[model samples]
Target: MMRITVSFLPSELLPKPLGAVAPDGQDSGVLPATAIVIDVLRATSVVSAALANGAKRILTFADLEEARSHAMGLRDQQEAVLLCGERNCQPILGFDLGNSPAEYDRETVQGKTLCLTTTNGTKALQAAQPFEKILTASFTNAAAVVAALPHSNQPIHIICAGTDGSITGEDTLLAGRIVDACCKSFGAKIDNDSAEIARRYWLQDEQGQSLAERLRQSQGGRNLDRLGFGADIQRCAASDTINVVPQVTARSPMEIAMMR
Candidate 1:
């Protein structure tokens, strides 16, 4: 394995609420060729759909108060700033929208800026801040995100927005998909055991059960179900449904725009 940790390399890289797992057994410091942020339950999926539908930009914040402060400023500058986020899979009080992809329809989200703070996704973004390049992924846009990556044969890091500080199955599933995609696209090496395991998961049941069912089976998925948001899970798990790769690039504080 070209992956060696604590060789904790000279270069640095970066996740926040759904923080990246500690690189305990894997390479610690070497920066990945590219970092893939996964919040398969809803965050990245919603972002993909939001941008694809013409939403102006999504401003991510880990703190709800910070998001609120930014929302006020953005609203003052533009009338269309909407507060979107979740607290334990439910809408935050006084916010304009919940963290459901279906809620961000073209009519509501189009031509507007969404100030989003999710339980895991925004935290994941915070965690990935130091990364050279950050790309958001969800089953909803797996194929498109894979297609957008450079086939340069560099290491790809899949950062899962694990639920409540632990890995979630949905996030792993997409990471696996990305691993499989990279193997074919660039013959990328599976640097660690977790990455290899995720790849195997994606390989095991590509077409057996509906991805929605798999999502529903996850902790994040079941929580959504308990909250009567089963429909959101279906939307999140629909692979390749939206063909947008959300790349975080220069402009301003963590603004995600679809990379063409």
Candidate 2:
């Protein structure tokens, strides 16, 4: 049976391979599974928009300077490169673009390469390196992501990139939505308590609140609002609008491209 696991936060994720046992009787090594990384409040959303709108590829960096340096190097080679990211919920001062999905419109990102970094999203992607396949998911491309899942028995892990090292409701909610979809579409079974909790959370309604309103109440949403990004919250909360799934196509510089 296809098993699905959810990691509410990157820290909560095991050392990979779900249940692999090492020679010392310890859990270690990589998993021959697919990992979906969600950063609904922004990063993964941006990736979906950028790729869907025509960006050549997105290379993620955990460090702001590193991303800048890499973009500069690519630019020096006469390549179209844009440095994109955010710090403390605002765009980096010298970056060509911020973490907002709106900024990645086709006109700006088409045929260009993006070097991205962020507080939580990029870090979550780094932590998910142990999986055989890494895909980025957000509300914008949720359905596309579900369609990209492998039908084999290999486990599927969903990792949520919470806000600032803490669990955020937005990420968990998206994770739950993915799990719920997998269960319905792939007949996948929830593998653990985290997965079950996430699935339940996604199905719960809070006093008739809309998904966008619920996102505005999340920790990451509030941060973006405080920084004058209220519009971004609505855009990020959009469900399955983008028809592309951004998968990690290269790992040397960690590039993400639309799955083809």
Candidate 3:
């Protein structure tokens, strides 16, 4: 049996393998297994909702300029596309929307392709692309992702794209959920340094408050509150809002499609 493991970030800051120095580029190396990347504060959650709402596709771009160019090209053909993302925790100027799942509701995103760029999530996905396999994960699709984990003999890595290049409570807590789900579903245990740290964080959150409440207390959570986006945080923290798993396929710009 392949031993499953999880790694919560900010990679370099976390300590040991749990917090490795995040790779310089996408070529981190062969993972020899699977990796589920998470940015539960909003990115991954929004991606899940967008796809569930019938988004034609989501094109994640690390650079805002590039994403805009792509969107402009898409628009030139008269195709309906929406440009959305955030920078410094606020909506970028001239974007169709920010990085909020509520903004991606069915009526808004259906039949549209999202051109997205963010401070961390996009960069994290790009940096971790060298892994053998990558999956996008969030609380919205935790159960489905748990069931979808590759059963072949290979380790699994859960990479949490924390906020502003730092590990926030929400992402680490989400990683903990994945780690716990794995332990219950696979009857396997993890030994990775990161998994241990994530497990501890999960247990801490589970001790008193509900997941949503815990998320509301995170660093990103407070920022969202001050910015009047508190509702978005609650929405993202809701468990199983949608049942589809979003996977990052082997393609450019890293499209997120429903894993079915």
Candidate 4:
């Protein structure tokens, strides 16, 4: 049976050998066959929007200056590149674009490479380097990501990019949504307590609150709202709006492209 696990924070994850099973009958050592990284508050959503809008590719970095420097190098070589990302829920100084899905329209990002850096999301992606296959997911492309999963018994892991080292409701909700979809579509079993908690949390109705409202209550959402980005929260709350699945195709610069 395929086992699905969820790591609510990047710190909770450890490199595991592929296909390894612990004495407790859980995944241990190197990561599983596939790993899905979720940062619903923004980063993964931005990747989905950029790719769907025809951006050539996205290169993620953990440092702000490194991303800017890389973008500069690409521009110096005459490559079409855009420096994109955020810090403290606001645009990095001088970046061409902030971490907003709406900013990555076809006219803005088409045929251009986006060099992105974010506080939590890009770090989560970097931490997931041990996985065999790495895919990015958000509310915008959750169904597409589930549809792209390989049909096999190999264990799959979901890594949530939490806010400031703390698990946030938005990422957990999306992770739970994916877990529920995988359970329904592939008959996969939730393999950890975190996964079970997320799945159950997603199944509950929060007293008539809309998805956007729920997101606004999350830590990341509140920060964005304080930065006057409530609209971005609404955009991120929309589910399955984008059909593209962004997968990590290269590791040297950590490039993400639409899965082929």
Candidate 5:
């Protein structure tokens, strides 16, 4: 039987060994567990929307410097690569766009490539690379992420890209959404503090609360809004807005595949 668990904020803030758990004595820390990397404020949501909107590919970097270098390297590759992401909610200088799902519309990313770098989201993706599988999740595509998994017996780690490495209500809410979906599929759950807390948050936020309203109250979401990107908040919070789940398949140069 497979076991499912949820790991929320500050988990990514620490360092590597981000967050791992085992179910039924299957210690996932010592083994490769599937990781669902989430950054609900923007990153993962933008990535999912971009891929769904026909963007050639999304290249993720831990910081702007690396993303810039990658962009330069791909200069000769045509299709006009665009540098996109944010730091503390402010758009990265010289980048074509910020980490907003709405910015990835068909008109802008129709046939272009995107080089992404973010304060928290990209870092979470890097921290979970050691996992057997890494998939990006957000409210926009929560159900799709769960369906993208391999249906394996291995434990699943739902890792959130929290605000400044600290768990925010928003990511945990998204994590809980993932947890609920996972429980529905596997019939088991993580009985830990982190998982239970996330479940509670998800239930509260899901109870007729507007997606933007829930996000605006979250730490990351608030900070991003304070930085003049409040509109992005509504974009990220829209449930089921997209159907693609971006899975990290390579690291050296960042490659994501649209699953399910």
Candidate 6:
């Protein structure tokens, strides 16, 4: 019996093999299920774009120092290593790129190894490493994320990478979209109220505005806008724009790479 659990950030109420959707993390008592981390505002969206555009691999880190250490390694091994990340909705002091989907393209990201750290996205990825399998997702690659889900008997968990400590609407919307798809394609059961709310949202439309508009109104979206990242909000909102689902191929030094 495959069950689907959805939760924003991390908590203590639910833990273990039953499945979990968490944005933050738990070292101990964390679930042993497959974890899908969604950062629709920018992080995972940019990951999808980077992979789709031809980036060989993406190394995600919750801490800047660890990411920098890995970046130095990449620089030694490869001629061009792209250091991309954001802190408080702004690019790091010295990075090749910020957390923006539009910035990743065939010309810039192609054949480069990306070392990325983000305020929310990378944190979720690190925390989810204890799961059986880890996946990165966003509305930009929702279809690919769904397609990558295996039909195993194990439960499925969708984690929404919220802004700071709060649950952001954009990530929850993507989680809902994924949950709705899982229910349809895998016949997976939604086992919680949060998942139910997301599923209901996935079934409804935006009325007049787009999914992007809704994100722009969110606190996460407003932060990006205030940081002069209005362009990124639009790019990240477009659904199915990219077709790559980045699955965590390596956990220890965290590598989210597309299966080529």
The C-alpha RMSD of each candidate to the native structure, in angstroms, is: 5.7, 2.3, 4.2, 3.0, 3.3, 4.2
- lDDT, candidate 4, 32-149, per-residue tens: 4798999998999899999999999999999888898899999999999999999887887789999999999999999999999998998788778878789999998999999999
Point to the candidate with the largest TM-score: 2
lDDT of 3 at 159: 78
Instruction: List the candidates' TM-scores in order.
Output: 0.85, 0.94, 0.89, 0.93, 0.88, 0.89
Cα lDDT listed for each candidate: 0.75, 0.89, 0.79, 0.90, 0.78, 0.81
After superposing candidate 6 on the true structure, give the runs of residues whose Cα lies further than 4 Å from its correct spot: 11-32
Clashes of each: 7, 0, 2, 5, 1, 1
Q: What lDDT would candidate 5 get against the real structure?
A: 0.78
Write candidate 1's Cα lDDT for 60-162 as tens digits.
Answer: 8888999899999977886689999998888999999988898888988888988898877876776666556778888878888878876654446677878
Better of 3 and 5 by TM-score: 3
lDDT of 3 by residue, 45-113 (tens): 888889989998888998999999999999999989999999977899999999888889899999998
Task: List clashing residue pairs in candidate 1.
Answer: 5-27, 5-28, 15-127, 15-128, 16-123, 16-127, 17-123
TM-score of 4: 0.93
TM-score of 5: 0.88
Measured by TM-score, how close is model 6 to the native structure? 0.89
Tell me how far candidate 3 lies from the true structure as C-alpha RMSD in angstroms: 4.2
lDDT of 1 at 183: 75
Candidate 2 residue runs with Cα over 4 Å from true position? 14-28
Better candidate by TM-score, 1 or 4: 4
How accurate locally is residue 165 in candidate 3, as Cα lDDT from 0 to 100? 68
> What's the candidate order when arranged by decreasing lDDT?
4, 2, 6, 3, 5, 1
Worst window of 10 by summed lDDT in candidate 1: 3-12
In candidate 1, stretches whose alpha carbon ends up further than 4 angstroms from where it belongs are: 1-32
lDDT of 5 at 21: 46
